[model samples]
Target: MSDTRRRPRHVGAKLLLLILVCYFLVPVWWLVVASTKNAEGLFAGDGALWFSGFHLADNLRHLITINNGEYLRWLGNSLLYASAGGIGCTIVSVLAGYGFAKFDFRGRNIVFAMVLGSVMVPLTALVIPTFVMMSNAGLTDTIWAVILPSLLSPFAVYLMRVYAAASVPDELLDAARIDGAGELRTFVRVALPLMRPGVVTVLLLSVVSTWNNYFLPLTMLSSSKLYPLTVGLGLWTQLASSNNGGGESLWNLIITGSLVSIVPLVIAFLTLQKYWQSGLAAGSVK
Candidate 1:
C-alpha cells in the first residue's frame, strides 16, 4: 500500500514536470522549424513542428540585407540601450539599496515604503505619463527618450536592498568607518565586493528588462533609424501582415529575426549564469 501511494505521487509529479517542459519548449521547437522555411513552406499547413527545408541561411541573408540593412542598425541600438542602461540602472540600484539597507536616515522607512509601493505599480501604466514628461523635455524620438527612462528601476533597487542587508555586515562597515574610511570609500572598497552576488543579479535583471522592453521604446521613438530590435522586428511583422500583396510574405523573416533576437539573451544567461549562481549562493550563505 505504501509503495503504491508513493509510486502514484511520483508518476504525477513527473507528468506535471513533463507538461511544463513541453509548454515552454514546444514554442521554441516550432520557432526553430518555422525559421527554416520560406513563406510557402512556413504556411504550408503541415509539418510546422518538423524541419521541412533548409532556408536558415537564405532567411538570415535577407534579414540582414532587408531595408538597406536597417536590422543591423536596430540591433546596434538595442545593444547600446540594453548595455548602457543596464549598467547605469544596476549602479543606481546598488547605491540606493546599500544606502537603504545600511544607513539610518530621516524618513528612511517612509521613502522605502514609497519605493516598494512603486514596485506594485505596473510600468505599463506609467508610459503615457512618462511620454508626456519626455515630450515636455524635448527628448522624444531620440535614443535618450528610451535610455533615460530605463535608468531608474524600482525593482532592481529593492533586490539590491535586500541583498545588501543580508550580505553586508554592519560590524564590518563600522570597523571601516573607525579606520577613517569615508562613506564613499567604504562602499567602493568594502561593501561592493561583499555584495557581488546581489550586484550581478541586479545587473542581469536590468539588462533583461531593457532588452525586452517594447512598449516604452515604441511610444518614445518615432524614427525608424533609432528603433531597437524589438520595435524594428515588430514593424516588419506589421508590414508582413498588412496584406498589401507584396512580393512575398515575411513570416519567415519574422520567425528568423525572433530567433536571432533571443540569441543574445541566451548568450547573456549562459555567460553570466555562473556568476549569478555564485551570487545566489553568497546571498544564501548566511
Candidate 2:
C-alpha cells in the first residue's frame, strides 16, 4: 500500500527534475555547440544551435594569440581576485557569525537584525556609495577597489550565523574552554571542523560572486591590463560590434573565450558541490 503511494511522488519528482535539468543544460549545450563554430558557421543561422563544424582549436588559437595573449592575463587576474577575495570573505563571515552565535554581548539582537536587513539590500544599490568611499581612500582604479569591497558578504555572514548556531555544539566549545583553549583556538581547532560544509558552501558562493562581478571592476579599473575576463570580453564584443570590417571579426574569439572562462567555475562547483549539499542537509535529517 505504501509502495503505491510512494510511486507517484517519485515519478512526479523525477519528471520535475528532468524538466529543470533540461532547462538549465540546454543553454550550456548551445554554448558548447556554438563555441566550436567559426564566424561563418555561427552567422549562417542554420545550425546556430548545434555543432555544424569543429573549428574550436582554431578559435582557441586565435583567442590565445590575440593582442599578445590578453585573455590569459584576464584569467589570471580573475583567479587572484576570486580566490583571495573568496577566502577572505569566508574568514570574515565565519568569525562574525561565530561571535554572534556563541557570545551574548550588547545589541546582539539589534545587530543581527541589522545584518539580516543588510542581506535584503542589494549590492548594486551600494555600488555608488562604495565607489565614492573608495575614491576618497585613493583606491579607485586599483586592485584594492575590486578586492576590498568583496571581502565581506552579509548573506554569507547570516548563513554562517544560522549554520553555526545549529551545527556547532556548545558542549564542544565549553570542553575546549575547559582545556585552556582560547576562543580563537577553540574556533580554529574544534568548531571549524564541524562546520566544514558551511565554510565550503560560503567559500564557493563568494568565489562565484567575485568571478562574475562586472560593474565594479568596470567602474574601478581604467586600464586594460587590470581588466578581468568579464570586462575584457565585453570590451572585445563592443569593439567588434562597432567595426564591420573583415579585419575585425571577433565573434568566434569572444564565444570561445567565454566557454573557456566558465570551465574553472564549473570545475570548482562540481568539486565542492558535495560539501555544499551536506551543509544544506545538515539538520534536515535530524
Candidate 3:
C-alpha cells in the first residue's frame, strides 16, 4: 500500500517536471527552427517549430554583412558592456558583501536596509531618473552611460552578503587576523577563496543582466553604434513590423541575430558551471 502511494507521487512529480521542461524549451526550439528559415519560410513554413529550409548560412551571412556590419558592431558593444560591467559589478559586490557580512561598524544595519530596499524598486522606474542624470552630466549617448549604471546591482550585493555570511566564518577570519595578516591580505587570501561560487554567481548575473538590458541603454543612448544586442534587435523588430520601406526583409536577419546573441551567454554559463558546482560542494562541506 505504501509503495503504491509513493509510486503515484513520484509519477506526478515527474509529470510536472516534464511540463516545466517543455514550457521553457519549446520557445527555444521555435527560435532555433525559425533561424534556419528565409523570409518566405518564416511565415508560410512547414511549421513554426519545425525547420522549413536550411537557409541559416545565408541568414548569417546577411546578418554580418548588412549595413556595413552594424550587427557585428552591436555584438562587440554587447561583449564590451557585459564584460566590463560584469567584472566591475562582481568585484564591487564581493567587496561590499564581504564587508557587510564580516565587519562591525556604526549604522551598518541602516545602510544595508537601504540596499535591501533598493532591490524592491523596479529597475525600469530608475531608468528615467538615471537617463536624466546622464543627460545632465553630458554623458548620454556614450558607453559610460550604460557601463557605469550596470555596475551597481543591489540584489547581487545582497546575494553576495548572504553567501559570505554563511560560507565564511568569523572564527576563521579571526585566526587570519591573529596570524598578522592585514585586512586586504585576509580578504584576498582567505575570505575570497571561500566565496568563489558566490563571485561566479554574481558575475554571471551581472553579465546576463547587462547583456540583456534594453530599457536602460535605450533611454541613455541615442546612437545606433552603441546599442547592445537587445536594443539592436528590438530596433530590427520595430522596423520589420512597421510595414514601411524595406523593413519586412529584416525579419529573418532578426531571428538569426538573436540566436547568435545568445551563444556567448550559453558559453559563459557552461564554462562557469564547474566553478559554481565546486563552490556549492565546498559550502556544503563547511
Candidate 4:
C-alpha cells in the first residue's frame, strides 16, 4: 500500500523535473539549430527544430574573418579578463575568508557585517561612481577597468568564510601552529587543500560572472579593440539593426557570433561542473 502511494509522487516529480529541463534547454536547442541555417532559412523555415542547412563550418569561418577577425580578438580579451580576475578573486576570497573564519580580532564582527552589507548593495548602483573613479585614475577603456572591479566579489568572500569556518578544523590549525608552521605556510599547506572545494566554487562563480559582464565593460570601455565578447556582440547586434536594409548581411554573422560566444561558456561549465559539485558536497559534509 505504501509503495503504491509513493509511485504517483515519484512519477509526478520526474514529470516536473522533465518540464524544468525542457524550459531551460529549448532556447539552447533553438540557437544550435538556427546557427546552422542561413538567414533566409532561419527566418523562412517552417520547422525551427530541424536544421535547414549545414553552414556550421562556413558560419564559424566567417565569424573568425569578420572585421579582420575582431571576433577572435574579443574572445581572447574575454578569456584574459575572466581567467585573471577569476583566479585573483578566488585567491583573495579564500585567504580573506579563512582569516575571518579562523582568527579573532577587534571589530571582526563589525567588519564582517560591513562585508555582508555590501553584498546587498546592487553592483549596478555603483557603476557611475566606479566609472568616475576609474576615469580619475586614467584607467578608462583599459583591461584594469574590468579586471579590478571583478576581482572584488563580496559574495565569493562570504561563501568562502562560511565554508572555511565549517570545513576547516580548529585542531588542524592548532597542530600546524604547534609544528612551528608560519601562518602563511599553514594556510598554503594545510588550509588550502581542505578548502579546495570552496575555492573551486568561488573560481567557477567568478569566471562565469566575469565572462558575462556586459554593463560594467560597456560603461568603462569605448574602444572596440578592448571590448570583450559580450560588448562586442552587442555592438554587432546594434550595427545589424541599423544596417537592416544594407547588403552588410550581418544576420548570419550575428547569429553565428552569438552561437560561437556561447561555446566557451558551455565548455567551461561542463569541464568544471564536476569540481563544483564535489566542492559543494565536501563543504556540506564539513
> What TM-score fits each model?
0.95, 0.94, 0.95, 0.96
Cα misplacement distance, residue 230 of candidate 4 (Å): 0.4
Model 1 residue pairs with clashes: 197-279
Candidate 1 lDDT over 56-90, as tens digits, reads 99999988997789889999999999998999999
Q: What is the full ranking by TM-score, best candidate first?
A: 4, 3, 1, 2
Give lDDT tens digits, candidate 2, residues 4-45.
999999999999999999999998988899889988888888
The global C-alpha lDDT for each of the candidates, from Candidate 1 onward, is 0.90, 0.91, 0.91, 0.89
Tens digit of per-residue lDDT, candidate 3, span 66-139 = 99999999999999999999999999999999999999999999999999999999999999999889989999
lDDT of 4 by residue, 174-267 (tens): 9999999999999999999988878988999999999999999999999999999999988888887887533346777777888888888788
Off by over 4 Å in 3: 277-286
After TM-score superposition, the amount by which residue 223's alpha carbon in candidate 3 deviates from its true location, in angstroms, is 0.7
Estimate candidate 1's alpha-carbon lDDT, on a 0 to 1 scale: 0.90
Better of 1 and 2 by TM-score: 1
True lDDT of residue 40, candidate 3: 85
lDDT of 4: 0.89
